[model samples]
Structure formats: structure tokens, C-alpha cells
Target: MPKESYNVIGVMSGTSLDGIDLAHVVFEVSDGNWTFDIEESQTISYSDAWLQKLKIAVNFHKDELEKLNSDYTILLGETIRGFIEKHGIGNLDAVCSHGHTILHQPHNGFTLQIGNLPKIAKIAGQKVICDFRVEDVALGGQGAPLVPIGDRILFSDYDYCLNLGGFSNVSFENHGLRLAFDISPVNTVLNFYANRLGFEYDDKGKLAESGKIDHELLSSLNNLAYYRQSFPKSLGFEFVKNTVLPLIESFDVSDIDKLRTFTEHIAVQIASALPKKSGKLLATGGGAYNRFLISRMQEQLPQIKIEIPEKKILEFKEALIFALLGVLKMRNETNVLASVTGAKRDHSSGKSYEN
Candidate 1:
């Protein structure tokens, strides 16, 4: 008989450089329905050196990145081992991880997420499931917004599931098809300007609240071609570095003003992407905590009720969903949706390393 329960740790590292998120979850299936309990969760912040390394890794050459990938895998393994020891966790099925994304240009026929080496199983002394995106890309998909599958199964009550992380992506059912795509750059750009002012991020967007929005800058940002693109598309740190930051730097405005304008830009882009019809929108991720940004979205989406879930779901939804992806992979079930990613077909996507 197929297993109906899984005890697993879902690990995630976002492009925002926020930190590594670890969630110890128990998922149970009954009568074809699934439910989950997040027993323990934590976010391990990266050191300054590591943060700087990841920020510039996108520009590293092949050989240099190869070494970085190996090193990152070791670090990732150690982190998982420590979490297990600290919590006295046992009887785990596997460690499911979305290794930090270094380069995600699927249009170029490739994507790179470091730290999925098979050695991770040896280091963590447990089975591991990871490197989930490469197969989707190989199958001619955007290899992104993989969380939508989890949404369709776990949080289907919401008409729309919007995750505001490094980038904002929304998943929803359209004509019985699951559709999702990256909406716009979120903390990836916001944190850039915030870091310029010696802060990790704009607290509640207060700094931006104090400044005036530069309409010209806002207009230029909204006009970004990526926003005009259709579903099955995604954004990465590369887009922010090569296109977004340079454009923002071209304007002669106060950093605070830039923050304000960009915040508005995010709101506008997200609002535009959502449907005008009335429905519930579940907003999660670090960006969901930004009260000001959420308010702006509420203003533009009056008909669409935006709901920020509980603390655990708000901060660790991706980790929890990634855990679901891992479970599906173990069952040899279809986890990547062709409708959402524009893949050639629906299939089970992940690498399994049994120790």
C-alpha cells in the first residue's frame, strides 16, 4: 500500500537573501484529502560574507560557480544536520530542499539552483529530495512557480494564492486549469534600495511612506516588458541586476523616493495581474508582512479580498509547499503542472538521494 503520511523537513532559500527557512512538518492523507501540521520552523540567517557571495554569484563564470555550488551543498548539509540535532528530530522520510537559485534564465534553456549535490544525503545522514527545477526546464517549461501545485491541493479554498517573496507570483484556477506566473519583482528590488540606506529592509515600508513617489520612475518600471509578458514566465535576480537596478539608478531621485516609487510600482503591477472579479486572495511570504504594501494592494483590489494567513503560513508557506513537492516526488506522482509552467506535459520532477 502507498504511504499516507510523511514526516519531513522542507528547506528553502529565497533570492531576497532573507535567510534559509527550515520547516519540520507532518503531512497526513485520509480518504484522498491531505492535511499538514508544522511542528517546528526556523529561519537561519546567512553571514555577511555568504550573503555577499550569493549576491554576486550570478556573475561568476562556470568553473567558479561549480566550486561555489559544491561549497554551498556542504553548508546546506551542515545546516540540516544541525536542525535535526537541535530538535531531536527522527523518523524522517527525507529532507526536501529548494536550493538557492543562482541563475534562472529558462529562456536560455537552463536554470541553476546550487546545493543539491547527492552528498547532502551523506552529510545529513538521511534521504534527500531536491534539484526539482532542472527536469521541468529540460521538459521545456519555465520551471518556476512550482508552488502552485501545492496551492491547488493544500489551499484550494482561496480563489487566488499569491506569494510575495523575492518576486511576486500568483496561482489561480482559470477555466479549470491551474495558471500561475511571476507577477513582479518584490523584495529583490525593495531590499536593494533598503540596503543602500544601511537597513536590511524597509520596516513596514515606513521609509517609503515618508517619501513621495516619482511618477516618471513609476511609469518606467510599470512599462518593463516582463510585466507585459504572459503566464508561464518568471523573474530572477538576473533581471533585477541587469535590467531593474540599472534603470532605477538612472533616475536622479532620493533613495527614499525611489523606494516609494518602486513600492507603488509593485502594487500597481500586482494589482494589474490579479483579476477584477471578486474572490479571496491568500497572500503569503515575507512581503505579506509589509503593511503599507498590503494596504496599497487592498486599495487597488477592493473587490478581491486579500487575506494574510497566520504567522506560520505567512513566513513559511514556500517551505511547507516545497515539502509537499518532495512528498509527491517520493510517491512518483505528478508534481509539476504543465498548465502552470507551460511544460511539455505534467510529470513528477525531482532528484532523490537515499542515504
Candidate 2:
């Protein structure tokens, strides 16, 4: 028997503004299979100041954004250093991070993810892999829903893979090709409304469960032109701010009513993305804890059997997937999917930093 080598830190901050999730994992690749052992994981919540700053950064002047990018890189470096010290695990290989997505408007030909990689490498004293989306976007891809590559590689046993994080996105094989995209808004809008209600999120969906579903609202959401646009489409903060929020605000809807209706809408769009019942489906992301949302999705999607994996997968799946993408990039494997992201071709994405 021989000793195996494994150690890496994965960092992910999603669009829901939930804050940063850090996973200390053992990614052991051997015998043509991948084995992941998550030794430690923690989430650091964002301060009110950070959240507000991120919201405004979307509209920031170029110079201001550039400045903030440097600042953010320092911020991430500090966070990772603290995380490493607290965990007390050594023998590090690398740190893979999916930094905060600041601006994602691929149609307009730009996406900004600001966090200083050199700074992270400097502070963390580890080889770093960050900025995982730019190269694909350069090829005219949506530069999002990048986790499908991980899903296809790590959890390929499942027929479909859906993640309900700040946003709900899904990936499944169709005609021998893996396809994935953002289905619709999830915690991004839910947290927005929940913040209005003085909470970070609608816990267990109790608030939504207590209220009535507005059929009219559900109909409007279901009829949104984006739903009919076909696959490979993604939703973002701008979509929520510009389209979803405005439409929801125009109506004199109750808080619970809005929550209930929106949960249903999420369930609807998620159901639409699923393929016909074949094998089990793997569902992860923060939104999986919303018992009401999960129940609703289960009811609507009777054909697909949905299973939420262990807590580590449910909470840190995106971070873990981003880490896997980083690994693929290190190996120079095909990471981006042309069919899923509308890129000119499948390519390796992300930049590397050496300490």
C-alpha cells in the first residue's frame, strides 16, 4: 500500500449575498475515480456594510471598481488566512476560490470578478487558483453555471444535478452532452424580500408556507420570456434588480404571499429543467434547507426523484465544485462546455497564482 496525497481549500461566495463558505477538503484522485473528504468547513457571514458595498459596486465607476478589486483581494486573503489558522490543518496543496461575482452581463461582453489573486497568494502563502470564469466569457460564453463541469465529473452517477443556492441552476446530460444553466432566482430575491422582513432568509420556508400563493404572480413568472428562450441561459443580480424586483414590487402583495408565490415559481422552473425520470437526482446548495421549497419541487417534479446529500454537499457543494474546477484547470483538462455556455469552443478557464 502507498500513501495518498490530498489537501486543498475551496472558497465560494454566492450571489445570494450569503457570505463566504470555506471548505478544507481532501480531493484524492486515484484509480480513475475521485474521492472527496471534507475535513472542515465554515461560512463567514457578510457584514451589512459589505453587502451594501457589493450592491453598489455593480454601478461603480471603472476606477472605483478597480480600487475595490484590490481591496477585495486583500479582504479575501485575510479571510483565507484566518480560516487556515482556525482549521489547524497543514500540508496544503492549493486554494481554489470562486470570488464574488460583481458584474455578470455576458451579453454586453464583460464580467467583473474582483479579488486580488496576487494578494491572496501573498497573504495565504499558497498557490491560488481564482477568477474561474473570464476565459470562457472571453470566448463569448455566459461565463456562469460553471459548476456543471464538476457535477459531470464528481457526481456523474446521478441523472440530474440541481443546486438551489442564491440562484437555482441545474445540469443534466442530454443526448450524450452535459447541459446546465441558471433556471431562475432563488435566495437572491428571497433574501431581498426577507431582508425587507428583517431576516436574512425565509427559514425552512415557514413564512411562505404560512401564506397563500398568488396565482397571478406565479402565472406572470411562468410566462416570463426567458423561460421560453431555451437552455444555456443564466440569471443574475441585475436580472433580479431590473426585472424580478420591479415586477414584484409593482403589485400590492403581502410579504408571505410574495414568498409563497416565488417559491412555487422556483419549483416550476426547476421542474422544467429536469429530464424524464431515469436515475436519482442530486440537489444541493443553500436553498435545499427550505423545506417548503423542496416539498413544492418534489410535488411538481414527480418524475425525478430528488435527494439532498450529506450536509457538507448541501452547504459547500458550490465551493467544492469550484475547487474541482480549479483542479481540472491545474491538470489542463477541458473545463468549460461550449453547449452549456454558448462559448465559441470548450476551453480551460481561470488564472493561477504561485506563492
Candidate 3:
């Protein structure tokens, strides 16, 4: 029989480069239903040196990337150790990590997430389950927006699960299948412009609120080919660098104007992706805190009720879900959904390493 309960640490580093999110989670299975509690959670900000390296890592050569991968694994191990010791965590069954993504081009049949090396298990002194995306992509899937499984199992009360992380993505059941796709860029683009103005983020979009929308830029963004694509699609740093940034840079607008225009674009795209029917939308991730953005989305999606959960769920939902993925992997159960990712079939995905 499968174990009834598990305690694990879920570590996540998003494209927004906000920091490393560590969540100590307890998952219990009762009568085939799953429940989770995030006992402790924290975000550890990255240093300037690490931040600079990671931002340019996608352009690194194969050997360089391998070295960085090893270094990052060590860094992740050390960080997880600190988190465990600081919280006095004990009896950990495993550490489930969504190692920081560097290159996510599923079209090319590969995606790379650093810090999943075997050395991590040794350094952290615990069993580790990670690299969850590669297998899904190997089976011909987008290999992203992996949190929908958690949404389906843990938070099934809502009709839609929308996450505004580095990128914006949404998942919901339709026609007896879970459908999901990336809607638009979020902090990945906004924070880039915000950094130019000497701020980490827009602080509830106050900067964007003060700025005017550039209609021309907005139209260009909306017309991008990615928007017209079907579901099971995703966005990555390459998309931002090659497609999004160039389009925005073509307009000689103020930084605040760019932020405002992009924020509006994000809201419109997200609203457009939803079904016309009225239902509850559960919003989470860092972007959920951007009050102005959420208000704009509310305006566009008036019929759909947008609900934001408590602070813990808002910030650490992805990490918590990654923990669930690890648990599913340990049980040899399906964690990656074929319908959501467009994989060949649903399967348990992740490599496990014992310390």
C-alpha cells in the first residue's frame, strides 16, 4: 500500500529571479483524496553575482553550462540544508526541487533545469526527486505549467487555477480533460523594465498606474503569433528575449509606459483565454499581489470571479505543488497529466536519488 503521509521540502526558483522558495510541506492521502499543509515557507533572495550569472546562463556553451549546473547543485544543496536547520525540520522523506530553469524549448525536444545533479542528494543528506520536466518533454509535451495536477487534486473547489509567476499560465478542466497554457509574460518582462527604474518590482503596480498605455505597443503585443496558438503551449526566457523584448524596445516609450502597456497586455490576454461562462478563478503566485494588474483583469473578466488566497498560498503554491509531484513520483503514480501537457500519456515523471 502507498504511504499515508509524507513530509518533504519543495524548492523552487522561478524565471522572475525573485528568489528561491522553500516550503516544508506535509501531504496526507485519505481514501484516495489528497490534502496538503505548508508548515513552513520562506524565499531566499539571490545575490547580485548569482543573479547576473543566471540571467546570461542560457547563452553559455555546453561545457560552461555543465560547470554552472554542478555549481548550482551545490548552491541548492547548501540552501536546502540551511532551510532545514533554521526551521529545525526533521524526518524529511525527500527533497523535491523544481530546479531553476535555464532553457525551456520543448519544441526542440529538450529542456534544461539546473541544480538537479546527484550531488544535491549527497550534499543535502536526503533523498531527492527532481528534473520533472525532461521526461514529459521526451514524451512530446510542452513540459510546463506542471502545477495543474495539484490544482486538480488539492484545490478542486475552483473552476480555474491561474498562476502569475515569471510567466502567466492557467489550467482548468474542459470536456473531461484538464487544459492549460501560458497566457502572457508577467514579472519576466515587468521586472526587467522595473529594474531599469531602480526598483525590484512595481509594488502593486504603482508605477504602471501612473503611466499611460501605448496603444501601438499593446496592439503589437496582442498580435504576436504565440497568442493565436492552441493550448499546451508555454513561454520561456527565450520567448521574452527573442520575441517580446524586441517588440517592446521598438517603441521609444518611457519605462513606466512600457510597464503599463505590458501590464494591460497581460490582463487582456489572460481574460481572453478564459471561457465565457461564469465561474470562480483562483489566482496565485507573485503576480497575484499586483493589485493594479488584478483590478485590470477583473475589469476585463467581470463575469468570472477572481479570488486570491491567503499569503502563504499566494506565494508558495508552486513549491507546494512540486512537493506533491515528488510524492506522486515516489508512489509511481501519474503526476504529469497528458491532457494538460499534450504528452503521449499521463505518467509519473522525475528522477529520484537516495543520499
TM-score of each: 0.99, 0.95, 0.99
Best-performing candidate as measured by lDDT: 3
Backbone clashes in model 2, listed as residue pairs: 73-116
Model 2 has a clash total of 1
Q: Give one digit per residue, the lDDT tens place, for model 1 in 1-355.
A: 7699999999999998899999999999988799999988999999999999999999999999999999999999999999999999999999999999999989998999999999999998989999999999999999998999999999999999999889999999989999999998999988988999999999988988888999999999999898888778988888999999999999999999999998999988988997645799999999998888999888888898999999989999999999999999998888999998889999999999988
Candidate 2 lDDT at 94 equals 81
Q: Model 2: how far is 114 from its true place, Å?
A: 1.7
Cα lDDT tens digits, model 3, 77-124, are 999999999999999999999999999999999899999998899999
CA shift at 248, candidate 2, in angstroms? 0.7
| Model 3 vs. true fold: TM | 0.99
What is the TM-score (0 to 1) of candidate 1? 0.99
Stretches of candidate 3 exceeding 4 Å from the true structure: none
* Global CA lDDT computed for model 3: 0.94
Clashes within 3 Å, all models in order: 0, 1, 0
